[model samples]
Target: MNLLKKVTALLLSLAIVIGSIFVGTKTNSYAATSKSYIKELKIGKTYYYNLDGGKYKDKIKVYVSKNDNLLLRINDKTIKVLKYDYEYSKHNYNRLPYKCNVRIYNFNKKDKSLEIVLNYREDLQEGYRILKFKNSKCLLDKIYNDSYMEKYDSNTGAITLSEGNWGLFKDFTDAIGRFGCYYKIQIKGYKIYNPYTSNTTEDARKFKYTADKNLNAYTNTNSSKIAFTVKRDEKVNIYSFYQKGNKKYIKVKNSSGKYGYIKIGSSPLFEEWLMVR
Candidate 1:
């Protein structure tokens, strides 16, 4: 009886050990399954499409939930619902009506890397389409004028010739007379600010130009003879004009009034610079 009791107790202990191991394995598997393969995207995160390998063809909005489901909205339509499964190294899904011909990526917040692959079909015959967003925000770099001559005084940070000399010219001809009686100025390194500011107010702004009808070309300062014509509705960097030592020269200006000179006679002034605002 004594031996039998000892054997019975040994079996019970062995059984408990085996059961504990089994339970641990199951718990681990369940935990792994609960994790999601796709990384969570924050609010306002966007995915851009590659149309011709040079520009963004389209964009998609990513909405992440606490339950690990990813919601994809394209052109205001909810097109995809992905389940987050963490056990696998990669997660992939396919659906129909892939009009944008772009891939969806899981935006990883930790390393700022996209982890998932999103593929779509496209038609080459159609030219690249521009992505439209109703209330989305985009990042824009600040542009500065590099070609103008910058001078720093004790009171002012950097003052260009155009900003200081524009007042010197009583009229448009007076400004032109300083530049050998020519009606054009060359500008370079025009910086485009993301959120534009003015002397009176700060607001969203883009680059713009106003030129006389005779001077319609627009180009970066380095390029020869205005590479393109300025459109009335197009956004442009403001090129500041100033005079140096009683001579008139064109310069690109920053918001701070710092200016850079552009080549003379390279492009004609379409109108008096006054109309550019």
Candidate 2:
């Protein structure tokens, strides 16, 4: 279950790379995009201001819910996007006022547009977004950024969206105030590449791995001491161990070699992201 949350969060981060990452043999299209009267700027300067987004991507940021303003400044005015308790036109989910955020950073001299990423959620459900500045205004072209979806539901005292498809915006379009999926992305002058790199040593690689699934491996037959747990698959080492009652136990070691124990048969290898160097 936790694995679902981790994977969904990951998928949301990679959301912006959708066209460039997943198109495979097909023609990769762009993510969510927005267009407004271009905001002119002066050379050799930077600006900062709070961001306010409305509906999907394109719409007035001012005079709207200003709860979750992550701050986006272009030139002199703040780019109001990334709104919490925001309403959607095309989204039909179980939660209301979906919690979403998009932060702009890493100014690229080559492209001249700010790098943007988003993470959206409803309670624990997942979603994400991406944006690119065109030296003037913001536009939603692509959507994919799993990094932002990692939020903790303080009320529940657990990782929010810890498990689910995060099928937030399954029907995003360029239409104003209407988006299909929350992973909707918008980019301008971005490098596209194969998300996966071909490496002959991949299969043979082994190192620290994140706990993709919830697991507990104990120490002795009495199980008095807990060896380690692969919870959330936080990179670990398959240390050493023995068996009890025809059942095998695995000694778990952290990157520091601190060890623990758990059952040998945990989540399948497919569920765990094989720590690759």
lDDT of 1 by residue, 219-238 (tens): 44444555344343232333
- RMSD list, candidates in order: 31.3, 18.8
Of candidate 2, the 10-residue stretch with the lowest lDDT total is 170-179
lDDT of 1 at 173: 28
* Number of the top-ranking candidate, with TM-score as the measure: 2
In model 1, which runs have C-alpha deviations exceeding 4 angstroms?
Answer: 1-166, 169-224, 232-235, 242-277
The candidate that wins on lDDT is: 2
TM-score to native of every candidate shown = 0.19, 0.28
| Model 2 lDDT tens row, 45-96 | 3434222222223222222334533444454444644543444511547555
What lDDT does candidate 1 reach at residue 203?
12
Position 72, candidate 2: lDDT: 42
lDDT (CA) per prediction: 0.29, 0.36
